[model samples]
Target: MSVREATPVTASTEPPPPALRASARSRRRRGGQWWVPWLFLAPALVLFLYFKFIPMGQAIVMSVQDVKPYLGSTWVGTANYGEILSSESFRSATWNTILLAIGQTGGSMALGFGLALLVEGQTRKLSFIRSAAFLPVVVPMAVVAELWRIMYHPTSEGLLNQIIGLVGLGPSGFINHPDTSLGSIMLTGIWRGAPYDMMIFLAGLAGIDRGLYEAATVDGASTRKRILHVTLPGLRPVFAILFVLAAVRGFRSFTEVFLLTNGGPNGSTEVVMTLIYKLGLEQNRLGVGSAGAVLLFLATLVLTICVQLLRRRRSA
Candidate 1:
């Protein structure tokens, strides 16, 4: 054969280079470490199952059973649920709770976001203000309720009324009047909760890129315009988280209502938690109370899920 013909034509397909093959093998080995994430997550999964999921399951089971001290427990199906749903007291309490939640959540979020903006860039002053704001959060809720109760006393001897008197508003019934009792409780809740919201917002604000603000300023954006466009967008995640948290807190609230009003003043300040307390403790209707708790839990779960879905849509 001629020398040129002796060299066979090279095929188009060739084996991968050794380095490429080695890299592929290495990636496969590394990908096997996916179990690392699950391993790390195991503790949290266990805790959630034990504390949250298990208790919820138990509550659901208890909700369906009629429990009596002397009489044996019996399954009553949806009877307890129907009772709460049909009761006039439950309807009024539901309305009161919704109002309280709206007032508390709105007031706290607005006040907190404002405070966060005010202190965002000031390192020295931020520490002092943050500490002062968070101090109320650390105080026991019971103590806060007691303190506010004293301040909300209906008589002129009350601290709040005394202050109003100094301003010539005369003695106003802060908690005595049904018209004002729920509102007064909401004010105290706002006072205690604003600091926590402020801290969350402050953290979010701190993490926001300074370049965005600088770019807006370079474009001659007004402060309000920059806040409307940049700051709010940056805060969307924080806002979602805070909103869910505040809603849950508002729904499950009991200590303050119990201590301050005890669902009194013609049931104007009554809420689901207080209602549950009356059912379980006073009326000794354990099954009914359990049902109420289960309903509340389900409601909270639905709200939280809705908020999360909305946030995901916004982000997308």
Candidate 2:
């Protein structure tokens, strides 16, 4: 036979191996499963778009328009923003807002974390204490403000003043005095918000693996050392989230300030939110109010971004 004819032809074309075929089938299955997550996420995404993103877009548009009372808005690009930034009231309000944010956020987080640490291992009576700590969170802000206002009244009839009088201290107008008004408002905010932070910290503490504590104990680690090395590391994410949330809430505080002091005592308690409310509702200057809102939005955005970046860095 001729050599060419005698040569057997080998099969070059073959079906994919079983593993490759199974992998391809698995990928297709995964593609089908992708819709499940999307389906679950659709409702939340729609709500976010409708409520958050759309309102933000509208606010940005409104910031540039001059909306007169009883007359429709007219486009006056950037004029409202200029006026808002240049106004003395805006400057003072911004300062007060910053002070409130710093005081409330720092004070609440510190007190809450301390309380969480104290109650971390307790089981019986601590549960009742925890509930008591969290009760303020359920109370409405307006009600808390009004309650504090009565307690902070400038007269001898005030609860705080009566207590001070028992100690031979002169009655101090806690909420009416310019020097004390901002601080008093900050204290109220801290009292109202600390419970939430405490709860968050408690949840984070509960999630920590007990094995780490046991291992540290075996290594003769002190309680403070264990906390510094283990507990704090475990709580980093919770702390970051809580701090950002508290900062945002404190910065936007309005109802409490409005109900308690109405930015009184020479505007010592004035905050950005109160200014925005006055500009929009009282003065009928929607454009200026929108500008203040936009500024607050930007500040919050910046803070959120910074927190996210810090979290990523810590995780890495």
Best by lDDT: 2
Residue-level lDDT tens digits of model 1 in 146-188? 8998898888889999999887997878777888999999999
Question: What is the alpha-carbon lDDT for the whole of candidate 2?
Answer: 0.93
> What TM-scores do the predictions have?
0.84, 0.84
RMSD of every candidate to native, in Å, equals 3.8, 3.7
lDDT of 2 by residue, 1-316 (tens): 6566577889889999999999999999998898898899999999999999998898898899998757788999999999999999999999999999999999999999988998776677999899988999999887898889889989998999999999999999888899999999999999999999999999999999999999999999999999999999999889999989999999899999999889988999999999999999998888889999999989999999999998899789
Candidate 2 residue 314 Cα shift, in angstroms, is 3.5
Cα deviation of 208, candidate 2, in Å: 2.4
In each prediction, how many residue pairs overlap at the backbone (N, C-alpha, C within less than 3 A)? 0, 0
lDDT of each: 0.90, 0.93
TM-score, cand. 1: 0.84
**Candidate 2 at residue 25, lDDT?**
99
